[model samples]
Target: MKDLEGKTVFITGGGGGIGGGIAQAFAERGTRIVLADIDQGFAQEEASRLPRSVEVMTLPLDVRSPESWKAARVEAEARFGAVDVLCNNAGISTGFRPLFDIPPEEFERVMAINVTGVYNGIQTFGPLMAARREGHIVNTSSMNGLTPFASFAAYSASKFAVLALSDALRDELAPQGVGVSTLFPGLTRSRMSQADLGKISAGDPARRAVIEANMMEPVWLGRAVVRAVEHDEPYIITHPDYREGLRARHERILAAFGDPAQPDYHTGMTATR
Candidate 1:
């Protein structure tokens, strides 16, 4: 995990914005790249752009499908020894809509790709990494995963699930020497937002405004991910502004607890006074 040179990275959504950036970064480091995406053409195009010296393969993949994962794993291992890293970077957003107003299918699709898709990646690639006793897994959660966002209930819920999943997996994999890291990227300039949400008309102007405001360059996120892997960081957060929000949320949780040593809150307060 420390030295990426000549290692192989199996990346989901490699044709997409953040995924492409991640692939490019690793490829630049002389890492072998296995790029998977739902769009075959796009994946192939990205793979072709990588340096000739780097071993590259592109496969059309649907993260929602377990069969797709199995096939890709087989092909990757055959092409490059064992995968050194698995980047679960593929995701989609349901755009800005009140929970009640959102279609049921929209919620299901988002959960399938954003939440279950990540679970599939971990489940599929985890065993391979375990066998090697040396590997890294990076799951992409969003800034919304750390804090609730208005009109993005489904997307937020899925990301929150990813955050919890990554944490649990990290604990489970630690003893095995496999590294698990979760990425919380802020608004990045990616096709994920535009492609996923562009179809739905935003009923509220304020909601649309908030979405537009959070967009950042995907390359910034890519660089952060590379650094995280180098440092063996468990949690990679892209937005600095969200730190205050995370702190506030933590404070709220701490506030909810009473002194466990005290049988009665009134008595405890009276003694302190």
Candidate 2:
């Protein structure tokens, strides 16, 4: 996993901000890349930005469909052999609306792409990587996944599921030499972020400007992702500013673990007369 030169990576959402950035970082490392997106044009456009010397492919992938996943695998493998890395970065947002106001179908759509899409990618590529005994899977979560607020509940839930899935999958894949990494990014420059900013700061131009200025360039996040895969790191936290709040949240959860519910029911003592 350390040396990524010549390795092949398949990235979902390759046409968009973070995915494009990740493709760029890996391309710079001389790794062959497959930019898979629902929008073929976006994937191709991202592929176009890479250095001419890098070997790359662009394919349309609807992460939600098993058929699409299989097709992508077939096409990418045909072009580059087995994929060495899978980036489950394709996702959608639930907007800045309250959970109650979100439509059921819209919420389902978000989960299908944001959560189940990752599941599909792993199912499609995890076995191949495991059998090969060398590969890395990077699943994109978010800072919201760590600290969910009222308005962002649905998106946060989907991302939280990503974290949970990656954690368990890491253990399951470790013996097979496959690595799983969870990427928790904060506010970054992307189509989703821009739309979120608009919803979050409707009339407040000053607030919108401040948030826009703080947005991290997607390439830097991509670079971090590349490093994480190389080192087989489990968790990649791109924004350190959220650490304090996360720590506090963890501390609160810890405070609730005092004792078992039934005081007289001690499992250590065998039930006998």
Candidate 3:
């Protein structure tokens, strides 16, 4: 995994801010890239930003569809052989709406893209990586996944699922010589984040400017992802500002653990129950 030069990397959502950043970072390492996005134009835009010497391609990919994944994989492998790194980074958000206020369809859409999309990518490409016994996977979650926030319940739930998926996949792939890493990003400047800000601020210039000022550059997050892949790290946390909040949440959960509902319930005695 440490060796990336000449390696082929396939990224979902490659047209978005974070995905584009990740592509640029991989380009810096001499890694060939396949930029797949639902919007082919965006993918091409990001691909254009990479140096001419870097081999990069853009393809329209609907992460929600297995057939799309199959086609993308076929094209990517046909162009550059087996993907050395698979990034399940395509996702959508609920725009900071309250849990109850979100429509059922919107909630479903978030889960479809944020959670199922990652699953589809893994199902499509993971087996190939296993057969090769040499590859890495990076799944993008969010800080909200670690510490759920109000007004972003559905988004948080999807991200939490990503974290769980990445952790389980990491363990499952370890024996097969494939690695998995979960990226928990915080307020990175992206079209999605910008749109969210516009919604909340009602396009208020001052508010939008303040939010923009605090946003992290996507390239920094991209570099972190590269490092994680190189070291086979399990978690790539690009933002530590939420550490205390996460610690408090975990401490509260630990405090909640207590006696079982039935005092006489023993570890092995409940098997038949």
Candidate 4:
């Protein structure tokens, strides 16, 4: 995992935004890339723009579709000897709305892409990494996963699911020597904001303001992911400014519960039971 040079990275959402930035970062470092996106033309276009010497392949992928993931994996393995890394980065927002106000179909759609899509990526490629005993999986959660927002209930829920899944997978995959990294990114300049927010009703000014305030350049977040992979870091947080807020939230939770038992001090104890 430390050595990215010549490693093959299979990336979802590779057509544009954060995914494209990540692909370019790796490609610049001489890593081979397999670009998978919902839009086949965009995927191929991105692949075509990669450095001439870098090995690049493109696949039309609907992250929500298990069959698409299966085909993509098969093609990726066939094109490259084995995928050294898998980036589960494709996701969508449920247009800014309160939990009850959001349509059920919108919630379902967001969950399908944001949460279930990540699960599919892991289920499909996790075994291959386990067999090789040398691979990395990066699942992109969000800052909203760490801190709840009033307007983004569905998106927040899906991201929280991703965060929990990444934590569990890291421990599960440790014995197999495959690295699992979870990313909690603050707002990034991406299609999610443009497409999802643009679709929102014009009356929702508060939600629009919130989205605008959180925005950061996608390339910056992409570079952070590259560093996370290189360092084998378990959790990657893109925005440093959010640390104080996160700490305050943790403190509030601890105050309400009178301090949870420490794992190190409590031996042979299960939190679930």
Which ten contiguous residues of candidate 1 have the minimum total lDDT?
Answer: 264-273
Give the worst 10-residue stretch by lDDT in candidate 4: 258-267
**lDDT for residue 236 in candidate 3, whole number 0-100:** 93
In TM-score terms, candidate 3 sits at: 0.96
User: How well is each residue in 134-205 modelled by candidate 2, as lDDT tens digits?
Assistant: 899999999998988889899999999999999999999999999999999998999989998999899999
Q: Residues 89-196, candidate 3: write the lDDT tens digits.
A: 999878878899998999999999999999999999999999989999999999988999899999999999999989888888898999999999999999999889
- Candidate 2: worst 10 consecutive residues by lDDT? 264-273
Q: What is the C-alpha lDDT of each candidate?
A: 0.85, 0.93, 0.92, 0.86
lDDT of 1 at 264: 52
lDDT for model 2 comes to 0.93
Residue 228, candidate 3: alpha-carbon lDDT: 94
**Alpha-carbon runs more than 4 Å astray in model 1:** 196-214, 259-273
* Model 2 quality (TM-score): 0.95
